[model samples]
Every structure is written in structure tokens, then in C-alpha cells.
Target chain A: MLAKRIIPCLDIKDGRTVKGINFVDLKDAGDPVELAKAYAERGADELVFLDITATHEKRKTLLELVEKVAKVLTIPFTVGGGINSCEDVAQILKAGADKIAINSSAVRCPELITELANRFGSQCVVLAVDACETQEGWEVYLNGGRIPTGIKLFDWLKEAERRGAGEILFTSMNHDGTKNGFANEALAEISEMLNIPLIASGGAGNMHHFADVFTKGKADAALAASVFHYKEIEIPELKNYLKSEDIPVRL
Target chain B: MEKQNIVIIDYEAGNVQSVKYALERLGVNAEISNCEKTIRQADKVIFPGVGEAAWAMKKLKETGLDQLIPQLKQPVLGICLGMQLMCAHSEEGNTKGLGLFPVNTLKFPAEDKVPHMGWNQIRQLKGKLFEGIETESYAYFVHSYYVPLNEYATAETHYIKSFSASLQKDNFYACQFHPEKSGDIGQAILNNFIKL
Candidate 1:
């Protein structure tokens, strides 16, 4: 049986982790490498570093950080944010990232997905879709869920899969940060539609939210940020809870 | 034991850096090279691959590794696509493999998710590759195709069905999972391989 994964997503800015991470023992909370090592030690199945840095010059810092993180961490990690081309992905993978997630760049040119899948293999390509519920339907969003693309979520997801996206990381803007729950209805539909793995993101407040995402949403993995960063939910404890609920997790 | 000369074959198949880093953590430095002479000289060779079968086979053939690999006398371990390529054939890309394992790689039936991603257990363990590792230990796996149960399989994992998680035949060993990324249990397996 393939175990459901628990991932901790960290926002990176100028090679440093943004958004307060409340680990008391952490020597440097802003250090992405240290935070990543901590999360992995606590039973995080994987880690995602979303580089939020704006400047092109700062991109080099992210690559250095990725190399440092890859050297120390044993688990799989994905590097995303501002990855635009095959060259960018090559550098990241060369820097030792296990996978690379592309969002807006993929929307701008869908061929990038096929090219990446062909060159680097589909296993390392992750298509992250930011979506929001609207009067029309679950419309895909861009630029960190600020701009709407008018494309329906299901339609875009179908295209992404067809374009050779190995996995889908779907984050619902409406439910994100609400601490309410996941968009299970939409997630279940997407999971049913695609053959690849689906990673449910956003609206993860409690451990039950994790359970709901896996059981109700049928997500192969669940990713959360603040809840994990602030110690609102500990990974080992959460895995124990999931195990009790009959959800398969690596202990 | 004197320092073992380890070489990880690099043919632009996929991420070989992760494998190097994993070995580094074990205090063993492994040279990453595609050169036939370097691979032929190493005491142990690690063939790490990730990607399409036919395409990888093309790359291997271009480097003349397709001939050198099957003849190596030292212990040679293959990972993921490396493991699949050790088999006789693959349904992916209709690829003919190295024919070392006498098995065939086939795509997972569409009854479940295509790629068997995330952590899964390897059971019915046999051979020194899994020494000191418990049976049913979890290892990280990410692939759409799998090698069905066969005589060469030293370990088995059940996804859509029981498939070869690890295979061993004489000096050749292979694993369908990414032991480099499988945390403690995976590290232990790598340690066992290094000792072998």
C-alpha cells in the first residue's frame, strides 16, 4: 500500500524562509535548510520550498539554498516559484531538488510541460494550479491566486495531465488560510479525473482536515504551511492520528 | 575494509545528485561518471536512473554503457528506471532492456493511480541488500511502470498487485524505489549495499 504523504510547505524569500515558523529549538527559524531538516526529522514525508523572491539576482540564492538543503535532507523535496523554462528546471534539479513545480509558466506555454516531461521525465514535473470558486466555476488563478485565467479548473487540469504533468498540486484560494477544511468536493472530482497523483493544498487547520483531504478528498498527499510551522499540528502526532483513522502513513 | 571505490553511472537519465548526497551522508564519497573506464574500475557501481525507458536506453547506447554494464564483475546496483532497464524488456516505449534479470517491466493497470508515488513497504525480503532491515519496511517509490513478481525479485511490494521491489541475480542488484529518498530505512538499505 502506498502511504498518504504529509508535506510542509515553506515560503522562501531571498534565500530565507518567510512567514514566522515557531520552532523553539530551531537556531535560525528563517533558514530554509534548518527548517527543512527539522521537518524531515519530525516525520514529514516531503518538503516544498516556494521561492517567493522577486528579483532575478536573488534566484541564485534559492539554488544555493536548494543545494544546501539537498545535502542535509534525506527525504524528497520540490522547488517552485518563478521557474520559467527547461533551463531553470535543469539548474534546480542539478542543484539536487527531487521535483520542480511550475504554475504560471505552464499556463503561459503548455508546451513547457511536455518538453519538461520529455527531457527530465514526468516523475519530476509537478503542475501546481491555484483555483478559486466563482460564478462561472472553479476558475484557475495566476500570479499567486490574484489574477483569474477564465479557464475552468477541470478543463485546465485535464489539459495539464494530457501535457504530461506527473502530479497535480491543487490549491483552492477560497478555502486557503480559512482553517475551515479542504475543498473536498472539487478535489474528489479532480482525483477521479486524473491518473496521476493529486496533492491537496490550502484550508488545512486541524488533523481532521488532513484526514478529510485523504479520505473524502482522495488526495494522495496533503500539504500545509502555518499549521505545521506554528506547531498547531505536529507531524508525528498527526501521522499517529491518521494511522488510528485507518489512513496508511509512514511511521 | 579499505575504502571501496564506488562509481554512480551518469548518462543524463535523471537526478544522480541525490544518490551521491545519500552516499556522502554515509561517509562514502561516490564518483559520478559516464565514462566506461571509470565505471569499470570501481569496486562497486551504482546505476541510478529516472525517466522514459526507450529514451534512457538510447542515452545508454550512445554512451556505449549498454555493453559495459552487463559485463561488470563487481557488484552493480540499479535504481528505479535503472532496475527496469536491467530486465529483458519494458512496455514503456517498447524498450528492449539489458536482459540481466530475465523479467519485463509493464505499466500498472488503470485500476488505481498510474504512478505509485509515496511510501510503500517491501516484503518477502531476501539477500544481503536488505540485511538488518525489517521485512515490510517502507520505502519511497514514484513510477508508472513496475516489474511483475519474478524469480529475480528479492523483495516484493504490493500496489495494484505484488511487484518486484528489489531484484538480485548473482552480482546484479536493483530496486524500483528511491532508497536515496526513503529516509532511515532507505539509508540502512544503502548502507547494506555499500557493505556488500
Candidate 2:
């Protein structure tokens, strides 16, 4: 059986490591290459580098950053943020990113998903969806959760899967930054709906939260930024905890 | 003594850099090339692939590497689709493979979830690639199709069914999983391959 993954997401801004809450007010974490090596040594199953403020210059800078980090990593790492076109993805992958995640670009042009999957294989194309639960219902958001779209969460998820997305990086806006717990109810529903792997991001506060996300939420992988970036939870020991809980995590 | 040369066949499958970096971290700098001369001179050759088999085979044929690979005297290692391409055939794209091993690659039943994308345990190991690797240790994987257990299989992993995790025949070795992305255990596998 495949083991569940524990991933640490690094929010990269201005070519340095940064962490943010609800996608705002960035805090410097450390050097990306340094943090990446630390995570890999500590048994992080994977790592994600999301360039928060991805300007044209910052994109090139992040590209270089990905290269340096890639040189030291022996684990699979994903690069995201401001990946608008196939060309951008190509450059990132060439710089040693095992996978590429697209957000706003995928919303603006769904065909980019198919294009990436076709050109690079579906295994490396991840669809990152930022969704918030509202009184009306759960809906998709764009531009780092600033704007809302007419597309509902389930509808967009189904469409993304149909368009050859290999995995779904579902971030619940309602649960993000609160550290209460993952949106287990929504994650369970989404996992049940899709056969592909679901990476539950946004609300990961503690080790037990990781356990809940896997056993209750049925997520194949759990990604968190603050918990790991701030040293609130150590990855190696966390994997031990998950193993004790029979969560089947990579140690 | 002449230094050992490591070559990663670049058939446009991409992600070859990760493989190169894995070796360089172990003090073995690998040269990525598709040129016949560079590849033919390798002490150990790493055939890495990540895309469609038909497209990969087409790229190999274009560079005349398909013809060159089988004739090499050095130890050749294949990863993921590179491992599948070493088989006699693959159901993906209805393509015929290099036939280095007489096995055939088949897709996981649609009823059973596919792409098998995660780390899974490897057992029943009996090859140099797994010398230092702990039994029951997991290796990272990402593929829908797999080569079933065969005479060439050196290790096995279970998903929808028991499949060949690693295969060995003569000087040729291949792994269905990505050792380059599997961290420490994977690094050990690559180091073992270099020693071979």
C-alpha cells in the first residue's frame, strides 16, 4: 500500500523563505536551500516552494532558488505561485522541480492544466484550489483568496480532475491560518468524490491534526507551512507519532 | 586510475537534473547527455524517464540511443518509465519497448486506482541496488502502469497487485520507483549502483 506523505510548504518571497497566515503578513523563515535540506534530513516526504509575490523579476529569482534547492534535495519538491504558462512550468521543472502547481493561471485558463499534463505527464501537474466555506456554500477563490469565483468547490474539483490534474492541493480558506484543524468534513467529501490523491493544506496545527487529516479526512498527504516553519512540530518526531497512530506516513 | 564516468540519458523525458544532483551529492558528478560518444563512454549509465513511453522511445530512436543502449558494456540503470522502456512492451500508447528484459508492462485495472503515486515498501530484495537498503523500507513511486513479477525481478512491491519493484538482468538494472526522489534510502540505492 502507498504510504501517506507529510509535506512542508515553504512560502518563498523575494528569493528568501517566508511564512504567512491566511496568505498575508509574511515572516522570514530562513534560506530556502537551508530549510529544504533541514526538512529532507528530518524525513519530510516532500517539500513545496510557493513564490508568494511572483513578479517577473521574482520569477527568474525563484527559478534560481529552485535550482539551488533542487541540488541539495533527494526528495520530490514542487514549485508553485505565478506559474501562468507552459513555458513557465518548463523553466521551473528544468530548474529541478519534480512537480509544478498552478493557482490563478489555472482559473483563468483551464486548458493550461491539460497542456501541462500532456506535455509533462499528469504525474507532475498539481491543481491547487483555494476554497472558502460561506453561508451559501463552499466556493472557489482566486488571487490568494482575495477574489471569489462562481465555480463551486466540488464543481471545480471535478473539472480539474477531468482536465488531467494528477492531484488536488485543496486549501480550505475557512480553516487556513486558524490552526483549529483541517477541514475534515470538506476534505472527506472531496476525497470520496475524487479517486486521485488529495493533499489537504491550510489548517494543520499539531501532530494530532496530521493524524486527523489522514485518518478522518482521508487525505493522502497533508501540507502545512506555519506549524513546520515555526518549529511548532518537528517532522521526524511527527512521523513517529503518525506511525504510532497507524497513519502509514513515510518515516 | 581513470575517474568513473556517470551519464544520464536525456531522451527529453525531463527531471534528469534531480538524478544528476543525487549522484553529485554522493561525490559522483554525473554528466547528462544524449550524445552517443558521451553515453558510450560512461562507467555507469543512468537512463531516466518520466513521460509517455512511445514519445520517449521515439526520442531515443531519433538520437539513435535505442540502438546504442543495448550494446553498451557498462552497467545501465533505468528509473520509472526508463525501467518500463527496458521491458519487451508497454500497454501505454500501445508501444513496444527495448526488450532488455522479457517482461511486459500492464496498466492497473481502472477499477483499481492508478498512477500508484506514493512511497511503498520493497521486499524480497536480492540485488546490489538494495544492498544497504533496509528491508520493508519504502521508495517513492509515480506511475499508472507496472511490470509484474518476472524472472528478472530483484525486489517486489504491492499495490493493486504484487509487482516488480526492481529488476536485474546481466549488467542492466531498473527500478519502477524514483530513487532520486526517495531521500536517504534512495540515495543509498544510487550509491550502491555506482559501486557496482
Candidate 3:
């Protein structure tokens, strides 16, 4: 049996973590390396760095942060956002990210998935899908979940997998930032339909929500931003809670 | 403590940063390079990779690094695709490997659950890599192919079937799993490697 993965996602803006970390013991709220080290120390299975840098001048700083963060932790981490070409992927990977996630860029040019898969192995390629429920069905969105692509959610997932996506990271816009619960119904559908692992993201409120997403949602991994950033739920505590629920998670 | 020199071969196969970081955590200094001279001069060489066997092999040749490795007397560690590339040949792209281990790299049956992603405990631990480590310790793995269990098996793990989780032959060593991504247990394994 595979242990369910617990991943912490951070949005890096101007070489700093956007949602400031609230832990009293934490030395630097703006430091990406500090946050990642904290997560790894707390038993986070992986890390995600999303480039949301507001200023173009800070791009070099973002890469520097990636390198600095990559040095302290041993856990696998993925670098996402603004990776539009192979050159971009190469730079991020060189900067120390174990994997690369392409959300907006991948949707725009689906072949980018294939190109990356061909260059690197499929094991490190993550395809993130921002989906929202519509009258017809769940449709994918682009540009930080602001624009609707009108692409059928399930259809796009199938193509991405066909194009050699190792993992599909599905974030339900309806559930995102709402903290009500995960879009388990949608996740379960995608999990059953695909052979690869699925990471459910966006509506995590508590440890129970993580359990529900793993059990009810059939997600191989659960990712959250605000909950972890604000120190609402510590990763080790969550893993212990999952264990109490009989979930096979790495303790 | 004087740190040992470690070099992770960069065949453009994938990120060696995690491996480098893992070494650093053990108080060892490691460098990443595809350069023959840098690799040859290092105390220990790490061959880590993430790509198809055939394409990675092509890049190895293009860099003319293929001729430089395998001749060194120092211990060499290969991870995942690196381990596969060290074998006799891989079913992936019908590619010929370095023949360092004289074993075939095989893909799991397509019908079966593949990529064998995630944690599986290693039993029957042996050799320097498992030094001071308990048996049945888990490591992270993400690959569709595997090296069959043989006499060279240092550790064995089960996915579809029992396979060589780690191998040691002569001065060469390899692992099908990513020790760098594997946490404390992984760091222990790496520490053991450094001690060797």
C-alpha cells in the first residue's frame, strides 16, 4: 500500500511567500527556504513553489530563492507558475525543483506536456487543472483561475495524461478559498477514471478535510495553501490524525 | 569532520539538486557536473537521472561522458534511470545500457499497476548502503521499470513482484528508489554511502 502524500503549496511573490506564515517560532515569514524547511521538518511529503512574483525585476530573486530552498530540504518539491517553455522548465529544474507543474501553459499548448515528458521523464511532470462547476459540467480555467477555457474538465485531464502527465493536480474553484470542503465528488470521478495518481487541492479547512479528501475524494495527495501558511494545521499533526483514521500516511 | 567529495552526474536527465542537498545535510559537499574531469576527480560519483533510458543515453554520448565513467575505481551510485542505464539494456526504447551491472532493465506488465509510484519497504537489506539501517525501511519510488532480483541485490522491495531495490557490484551501486526524496530513512542510507 502506498502512503498518502501531504504537500504544502506556497505562492512566491517578489521572492517572498505571499500568505505570511504565522508561526511564532518561525524566523522569517517572507523566506521561501524557511517555510519549506519548516514544512519538511513537520513531515510534509513534498513542497510546491508557485511563482506569483508581482515585479519582473524580482524574477532573478525567485530563482535564487528556489536554489536556497532546494538546499535545506531532502523532500521532493515542484516549481510551478510562469513555466511556458522547455527553457523555463530547464532553469527551474536546475534551480533545484524535483518536478515542474504546468497549469496555464500546458492548457494553452497541450503539446508542451509531451515535449516535457519526452525531455524529462513523466514521473516529474505535474499538470494542474483549475476547474469550476458550470451548468453543463465542470470547465477548466486559466490565468490563475480567472478565465474560463470552456474545456471539459475530464476531457482535458484525459488528454494531459495521454500527453504523459505523471500526476493531475485538480483544484475545484468552487471549493477553493471557501474552506467548506473539497470537491470530492469531482475528485473521485477523476481518480476512478485515470490510472495515474491525482492530487486534490483548494478546499482544506482541517485535518478531517484532509482525511475526507483522501478517503472520500480518492486523492493520492492533498495540497493546501492558506491553511498551512497561516499555521492553522501542522503537517505532523495532520498525518497523525490521518493515521488515527486508518489512513496509510507516512508518519 | 572532513567532508568527502561527491559529484552527481548531470546528463540533463533530471534534477540532481535534491541529491546534492541530501549529501549536504549529511555534512558532505557534493557538486553536479557532466564534465569528465570533475567526475573523475571526485571521491564518490552519483549517477542520478529522470528521463527515458534511450534519450538519456544519447545525451550521455553527446557529452562524451559515456567513456569517462565505469573506469573509475571510486564507488559510483546510480538512481532510477541512472540505475537502469547502468544495466545491460532497458526495455524502454530497446536501449542498450552501460552493462555495468550485467542485468536487464524491464518494464512492468502494461496491464498491471505501473510506475509503481510511492513508498514500499525494503527487506533483506545488505551491503554498505544499508549499513546500520534496519530492514523493512521504506523509500520513495516512481518508475515503471525495474531490475530483476539477482545475486547482486543489496536490498529487495515488492511492487508487482520482488525486485532489486538496491544493488552493489564491484565499486558500482544503484537504487531504483529516490533516497533524496525519502526523508530520514533516506538520509541514513545516504550517510551510509558517504561512510563507504
Candidate 4:
């Protein structure tokens, strides 16, 4: 059986690593490449470098950053943010990114997912969904979770999958900065609804939350920023905890 | 002393740089090459790729490598999609491959995740590729379609189901994972291949 992954997400802004609470009040972590090497050495299964500023930049700079990270990091690295076209996908993949995550672009043009998947294979393309729980129930939001589409999370997830997204990185906007725990109910719904792997992001307080996401939420992996950036939960320690819990994690 | 000339075939696919870097890190004399004479003259060849199987195969066909690969005399190594393309046929694009190995690749069952992405354990080990690695040690994987286990299978992995993790047939050796990204175990596997 394939083992579940433990990933640390690093948000890059102007080539520097940054972490925020609920995607605001950004705090400087360190150089993106340096932090990536540290996480890989400390036993991170994979590292995700999100160029949060890519959407705002005049020209795409994530490719340059990916080239830098690829130089030092040996483990698989995924790059996301501001990927708009098939050429962007080709450029990043050529720069040694193991995978590329498409968020806003995917929502804006659903065909981009199929175009990428058809051209590069589905495994290279990932759909990043920022979802929030509302009175009408969980809904999908786009453009860094700033714009609410009012589309039901379940419907959007299914649509993304149908469009050839290999995996879905579901981030809960409600619990993003709270670090209380994952939106277990929402994750469970999606996990049960779709057969594809679900990467639970947003709120992860401690190692226990990681365990909960896997056991209770049925997430294939737990992607966190603040928890790992602040050193609140060491990757090796978390893996050990998950091992004791009978979850198959690569040592 | 004859230096082992290893050339990684390049056609703008993913994972080539890491493979080149890994070979360089191992102090192995390797380069990325697209020239026919260079590939034909190399002592050993490493074909590493991570992208659409159909498109990559098409690129190979366009370069006339699709024909050149099958007749090569030296030992050849293919990683990930490279391995899948060695099979007789691949369901990835209904692609007809190099036919180096008498096997067919198929997509993962729809009941499970389309892409069997993540690290999985290797079992039913065979050949020198797994020299020091113990049974069930993990290797990184990122593919949806897999070449089914057959007589050429060197190692097998179980994701949604048991599939070929590595395959070896005469001078051709292939793996479904990226050794350049698999850490120690992966390096060990690559080292064994280099020694081959």
C-alpha cells in the first residue's frame, strides 16, 4: 500500500519565505530554498512552495524560485500560484518541479485543467481549492479565497476531478489561521465523496491534528504552514506519532 | 581507464535536471544529450522523464529516437514514464512504445485515485537494482498508469493494487519511481544501476 505523505507548505513572497495567520499578517520565515532544505533534511515527505505574490507580480517569478529550490532540495518539490497557461506548466515542470498546483487559473478557466492534464498528464496537475464553511454549507472560493463563488464544495470538487485534476489540495478558510484543528466534517465529506487523494490544509495545531486528519478526516496527507514554520510540530516526531497510531508513514 | 559515458535523453520532459544532478552528485560522468552519435557512443544510457506518456513518446518518435532506442547495444535505464514507454504498449495515450519489454501498461482502476501519487513499498525484488535495500523500503512514485507485472518485472509495488515497481530485461532496466528524489534508498538503487 502507498504510505500517506507529510508535507510542509512554504509561501514565498519576493523570493523570501513567509507564513501568515488565515493568509494575512505575513511573518518572515527565511529564504525559500534554505527552508526547503531544512524541511527535507528534517524528514518532510515533500515540500510545497507557493508563490503567493505570483498573482500580483508583473511577470511570473515562481519559475526562477523553483529553479533555485530544485538546486538544493533532493526530495520531490511542488510549485504553485499564478500558473495561467500550458506554457507556464511546461516551464515550471522543465525547471524540475515534480508537480504543479493550479488554483485561481483552474477556477477561472476549467479547461486549463484538461489542457494541462492532456498535455502533461494528470499527475503533474493538482487542483487547489480554498473552501469555507457557510450557512448554506461549505462553498468553494477562488482568487486566494477572497472571492466566493458560492459553488458548493462537493460539486466543485467533482467538477475538478471530472476535468482531469489528479489530486485536490483542499484548504479550509474558516480554520486556516485558527489552528484549532482541521475542518474534519468538511474534509470527511469530500474524502468520502471522491475516490482521489485529498490533501487537508489550513488548520493544523499539533501532531494530534495530523493524526485526526488521517484517521477521522480520511485525508491522504496533511499540509500545514504555521505548525511547521513555527516549529510547533517536528516532522519526525509527527511521523513517529502517526506510526504508533498504525498509520503507514515513510520514515 | 574507460570512463562510463552516461547520457540522459532530453526532450524537455520533467525530472531530467534532477537525474543529471543525482548522477553528478554520485561522481558519475553523465550529460544530457539529444545527439544521435553521442547516444550511440555512450557506455550506458539513462532515459528519465516525468510528463505525459503519449506526448513524450511522440517527441521521441519525432526525433527518430523511437527507432534508435530499440537497436542500442549498451545497457539502458528508463525512469518513471521512461519505464512505461519501454513496454509494448501503454494505455496512457494508447501509445505504442519502444517494445523493449514484452508488457503492456494500464491506467489505475477508476475505483481508486487516478494517479497513484506518493511513495510505496517494493516487493518481489529481482536483479542488482535492489542490492542493499531491504524488502518493502519506500520509493517515490507519481504516475497514474503502470506497467503490469510480468516476467520482466524486477520489483513490484502495491498501491491500489500490486504493479511493477521496476522491470529488467536484458540490457534494458526501468523503474516506475524517481531514484533522484527517493533519498538513500533511491540512491542505492541508482548506484546499483550505475554499477551495472
Among these predictions, the greatest DockQ belongs to 1
Q: Which stretches of candidate 2 lie over 4 Å from their true place?
A: none
Clashing pairs in 2: none
Rank the candidate models, highest DockQ first. 1, 2, 4, 3
Report the C-alpha lDDT of model 2 over A1-251, residue by residue, as the tens digit.
68999989999899998888888888898999999999989988899899987989777799899999999998899999999998999999999999999988999999999999999999999999999999889999999999999788998889889999999999999999999999999999999899788999988988989999998999999999989988999998899999999878777
Candidate 4, residue A198: how far the Cα is off, in Å: 1.2
Preferred candidate (DockQ higher): 2 or 3: 2
Interface RMSDs of all predictions? 0.7, 1.0, 1.7, 1.7
Q: Compared to the true structure, candidate 1 yields what TM-score? A: 0.97
Judged by TM-score relative to the true structure, which candidate is superior, 2 or 3?
Answer: 2
Question: Any runs in candidate 3 off by more than 4 Å, and if so which?
Answer: A20-30, B111-113
How many collisions per candidate? Answer: 0, 0, 0, 0
Candidate 2, B1-196: lDDT as tens digits: 2367999998889879999999888888889999999998889999999999899999999989989988988999999999999999999999999999998999998664567898899999988889977888989999999999998999999998999999999999999999999888999999899898
TM-score of 3: 0.93
Better of 1 and 2 by DockQ: 1
iRMSD (Å), candidate 2 = 1.0
Residue B173 of candidate 1: its Cα lDDT? 95
Most accurate candidate by TM-score: 2
List per-prediction Cα lDDT, in the order shown.
Answer: 0.92, 0.91, 0.85, 0.86
TM-score of each prediction: 0.97, 0.98, 0.93, 0.95
